[model samples]
Target: MHPRLIAPGALAAASVLLAIPASAASVSPGAPGIGDPYYPAYGNGGYDVSHYDLRLKYQPATDALEGTATILARTTQDLSRFDLDFLLDVDEVRVNGARAAFAASGEHELEITPRTPLAQGTAVTVVVRYHGIPSSKQAYGFTSWHRTPDGGVGANEPEAAWWWFPGNDHPRDKATFDVSVQVPDGTQALSNGTLQSTVSRLGWTRYSWRSDKPQATYLATLAVGRFDLTTGTTESGIPVVNAYSKDLGAQAGAARASIERTGEIADWLSGYFGPYPFNALGGYVPNTTTGYALETQTRPYYSPRQFANGSNTSVVVHELAHQWYGDLVSVAGWKDIWINEGFARYAQWLWSEHEGEGTAQELADYAYASRPADDPFWTVRPGDPGPENQFHIAVYDRGALALQALRNEIGDDAFFTVLKGWPQRYAHGNATVADFRGYAEEVSGASLGTLFDTWLFQPSKPTASAARTVSLVPAEAAPARPRSWQRIAATNGVHEH
Candidate 1:
């Protein structure tokens, strides 16, 4: 069972303080977990993180990692102690430059108690020092940190960020980051944002990276390996950086050729989705691992096999589109994952239509008719498909169908208004499913209760509408599978890294 929030004893202390005229209420401990319906233990409450300063050193020979994380945060409520979602052993913890007592509870909770009770709205600095081998345990069908041939990759999603560094490891609590990693000579380290500086001494090099924009923990990525790093700028002057592993010898040329078109794609997307949300743009092509690609903040991660298969352009467009949909405006909870996947899927259709491959209407109509009436894919609601089925086909295909249906109901003008304005309004923030419905209504000046009910909430296949075409052909003519792009979309392209 997912963990629930453990309420503090502060109410009783407040009552005592109110009864006694001369006494003040004592601060109490914060809640151990944030109250999320899907994964309740994902984030901690009573504090807001502003920035994370992480310094890490990895030894590939032993698979050992030593890290010191200094987190800057502010309290939201009166607190004597608080918890961070951490899954490894901690050697020491300091709160506001003072030694603090800590204990490990449950699977991923680092409970820390400070020497003095903290007041509400007070700023605090926490430093944690730990040394351990990062876990490669699979959570949502992908390992959090995987040890590659030469080095390791840190690609965490949902509940796996705790396996590497300690923080309020959830998407709702976004923060800036300053990450630095030390590796052996002749190797490279890559992370989010811009490369700040690099210093080498005694056969060891430390590469520093900084992200000025607010980012969620799931979007945080760290890749350590021998890479051929390349840098350039987009037409609009956005910085572009690409890193390809030396192991991808022959396929590296095709990967670089496809990566060069990133600027043109971003320029096209900016015309429809407002401005690009990040300071940098590019991706990394590492040796094959998860058989998928991930939109890790500014720089996405891809497998060399994707390029070799001739799906490079479509995959690049899908991941780069996520910079606006998933990375910029995140979701409030795991249940609202369609807000991310759906938008990226629709972006793929939009790119296809622009390239003269197929229109979104045609794709949506095909998907609606391809499935049999009794298929479970259409029965599951994309809005809340539970934890285990979060990345199912319903979330991608059905979610995109919902958006396309909206585009048909509301004219192209209002629909495009929503596409552009929604991201700008909630830039670098989190939104829920209800928030999206309300925004669409507000922008279109029409009520869409029935549309959302049929597409998002109902538990069966939708009735045939004008958007769905009727077909009487052999099943082989129009296979029930998703289109080429949709096939890649099934990988839930955000988490695997």
Candidate 2:
């Protein structure tokens, strides 16, 4: 989740029967967390979700949402009780078609005890009925549910899913999604994947969106409003659908210009990171004050502020790069945010290079030379920047600096190999920082432990000049070249994220 706070974006199991023996069935409550170091209480255990069929009805006037989530999953261990990370008011819960006792626990856990214990490796279907005004609920001090001028939007990094639907909330439990949103007939609804149908009946229009690729719960978004929708195909034949709020007064033209480039940018990114990953491609701009843009699966969310000046494809590149670094190959833990933000922010530099505005090395040199050794910017470790600094500017810039240093150390051929090969190696899967280090080391055949430590792990600037050379300065002096890209990111972009 970029929490530029940009997004939340996520696994698979055997289909054949592999049930636990009767003697091994020791029913117990599933663990409350999936063991993420930064977000220990985030996702739950006991079950691995495969798909979520969310049928929802939303009212813009009341800002109320009523949904029935039909979840298909498998118990990873014998479980008498399981939890779906949620904050909505649950009306009823049924496990395997049997009514189950459910209750609210802690800040975001919807605790449920099925009528019968589930054996390990056994498939189960769960249905949850819930209704609430999402904006009215608050957990961990903030709400991701956003009430817009036209309708409602559920898009944020790290914690948006809690207020909308019930499920395994962390990126580790990836699942396919069928999000069908019903709104007033005149209004439009948008979500991830290809739109299957738009049926109007009884004064309401139901829009059905399906994501065949395994997606994290946070990447599942719901946008209901009056929108001017555009559909097209990229040069490579990838279907593209972009949405713009009908009421984006001053920002309309610029937002449209930037968002229309979704397919083009995705195509450009493919050259360095392989093919576009998802079946669908697009983005949306809702008139909201939320200062960040998020890579919400296929359709990334863009704040109007992102384009206040004009078309800003750099921010678009950052989020779309997430389609690879953050969306396709998710971070195993929130602490490993460098894999997401660093790589994505680096994409902006690459975009600058692609446009002939500036080469990546020039930007890297500028970043390395500009920041003082004593600045707090150097202290925020990119690899393990704790909960508070997960989205810190250092994680993005310094993280990219780390990559540039690696590219210099390993040479362009091997660096590009590691860059393009990483997403393929861990596609649709979760991985940690250690996993990335190993992959790069394997590809370049160089010891990366100290390099990574100095660049990402240490709380101080790098002392070794083993890679590319840069002239350090004490002042915030502009480098001899490439200051435009920095303005694009630092001026309006970094604050939002």
Candidate 3:
């Protein structure tokens, strides 16, 4: 089940003063799970995070990372204790600057019990000191954190932020971040947002980064390595700071050339999607450690292989577009992933159309006609695809196809309105599929239930008529279709003329 926002009345009812006599002094613990069906044990209830200040040091030789995380949050209900999704050996825990008892339990829950029961609407501060090898569990066929040859990359997507620091590790809870990491002198530590300052001392350096914009936990990143740093500004004046691995050697030149276009792409996307969402624009730690590139808030992480040739601008466009679709307006849960992947994929198609390669209509037609009726891609619904299929091709390809179908149903004006209005309305917050559908209907002034049902929910392939072109033809002039056997045989070995 999707987690619903807590009601004010319900929250008040949970408070100790309301539920029990004042003299009794009884308090209830916060719920461990936030009610997400896919990952029930992901986030905690009874509190909302406002900001996270993480200070850490890393040693590549021994693979050891020690950190102190200070989280400022507001209590939603009276609580004896609360939980944070943490997966490290904690040395000490403090609440509101006072010593608090804590224990690590069950997967990633760090159960912290304050010395005094916290009152509802009170502000609380939690500080945790922990140390160990930073590691991530495998989920959706990829590890969130990878150990690079020189250092390591933290790419906590889905529910892996706990591997590095404790927090309410879910997309629903977005918070600003101040992450500072100290590493070896020669190496550079990169993270989201603007580089506040860099200080060197005693063979070590500390790099401080500040992301004032509210960000989800999954989009938080920390990469440490020896990098060739490039700093500039986009045509629109957004700051651009990209870091390339020195290990690329000769390939570093081509990588830098491709990265230099970060400004150009941001300018183009801004024209279509309204103003850029964040204060910074750049890619970070481009290396081959991770097979795929991830939109890590202000600074995305790219794999060297993705941009090996100068011709791989589509992947760059895809990740940069995610800054608006995924990072700015995040999903409510894992089920709404298509809102992110679909928009990014559609941006690729739009870039292709803008470059005169092929129109989005042509791409949608090709994808619709290429897949067989029984293909699993069609069977798995993109809106609620399970955890295993969260990142499936259907999420990217079929999801884009659905958006194109909606665009064809509504004209370009209304479609463009949605593209710009979506992130603008829900910037720095979480949105669900229902929320999107209602917003689209409001903007387009059309009931899109049938179109959404056919494209997003139906298991079978939709008819070509679903994606009607802007210029319509007479019913009698419709194109004829091939027989089912012909399509099946073509999918198999035989092809019939």
Candidate 4:
């Protein structure tokens, strides 16, 4: 899941008092669009993000920074102009190494047009640079942190990225990213992908990380603080590295155990689905005020504040599941969010099955029976409802229930076949509910129109009874042994054959 946009439950409370900021006020450090943010210049087949290479030099001494980005993008069709979402403080813009005209600086997004029309599939290279002291209170395009006595602004929530480079702002447009940050000596910088390399420059250290896969813009993240690295491997042979604050104590045992469990979960899922889909795998536990975690490509950003006694260890599992479900097999749009969230939620339940906590069907039945039918979980449409609704339990839980329904109707073997085949068919691509239905029907050789129509298209739960019946083989009756959960368990005590 992406980090919360605001404090939990705060958005709803603030919604009633909502009024646009007087200007793009500095809501927090690194938030360039506080007053105004950049929007992307999209083409007909939707804004296509090709690649982003950001070069930034951070100077904590003066609390200032300078950076430039070389963004390469192409369109599905010819277009005269478009918009790009970048952080404020940009001083110049160039296209193909030539100075390009751009407007709306100090605003949230940048509007840029090439001197000549850009044809479909033609790549456009853009570059921009600027210098400024990022606010410590808010987060924006680029997050700047000063060496504080305790640490940097860990709790401060304006996610800074715009302050560092120019590109799309929203998660709707997914693309590859390469980030290079140069900071003063002794301080280490971390970003989303597997670390490509690190070198020390004159009085500064440059670190570069590359994600060779498509990623949501907001899911791109970086953490700069004194840090130490601990590395290990999963049972399935994937590299698992943990990055923690250098000043903090070492928890290698805990980290290794938790990460290895992620592999175990993935392996169990592979039996039902396919292999986990990503280049590398691991996490970075940065000190933060938030209690949530993020699925940032090969690695996820985890906040230590969120877990206690490892009881809530499933957060990492949930995010790890996202790599296969959400990151690799993405939803075509927000409306098809089930493909992203619902599958991941089921992955958690699948993990529970592996742990012997409960059977998959039992858990699904529990979630479905507990939640209301008219709940917003069923009402989610593809739109920017808000971050609060992004990982809504309803979406994850109820969505999982929908999958369980299919399993019940089709049976385990067929359902697992669809689960394993989905990522292989649409790896690194987008999918819709219709695509899922078609694929499932095609694979299972069964008609699922009614299943999809009632579960996905219908606004409310269907009134259909369980037409399929379940019977224990050989038809033997046993005396009720327990007092709860099942009515039969509380009644008779002897078995009759």
For TM-score, the strongest prediction is 2
Better of 2 and 4 by lDDT: 2
Q: Cα miss at 1, model 1 (Å)?
A: 60
Pick by lDDT: 1 or 2, better one: 2
Instruction: Give me the candidate number with maximum lDDT.
Output: 2
Task: Give the residue spans of candidate 2 off by over 4 A.
Answer: 1-25, 464-478, 490-497
lDDT score, candidate 2: 0.88
lDDT of 4 by residue, 1-497 (tens): 88856875787778744763432231221222212112212211324677888787766555566788788876545555556655457688886777767776444456666665556566778787766655432333333332332234211112335545556654445789888988888877777767888899778899998888887665676667676676666667766656766543344344444644555566556676677666567776655544456666677766554343343445566777778776777665555666866776677667666665665666655544444667665565312223435445556655776787788778888898898898889887777778888999998999988776655555554442531222121223332222222321111110000
Which 10 successive residues of model 1 have the least lDDT summed?
466-475
**Per-residue CA lDDT of candidate 1, range 160-256, in tens?**
5776789998888999999999999898989999999999999999999999999998788888888898888888889998998898867888888
Residue 208 displacement in candidate 4 (angstroms): 1.4
Q: Native-vs-model 1 lDDT? A: 0.81
Residue 446 lDDT (model 1): 91
Clashes of 1: 0
| Model 2 quality (TM-score) | 0.92
lDDT of 2 by residue, 60-104 (tens): 999999999999999999888999999999999999999999999
Model 3 segments more than 4 A misplaced: 1-26, 136-143, 249-254, 308-310, 467-497
Q: Cα deviation in Å at residue 174, candidate 3?
A: 0.5
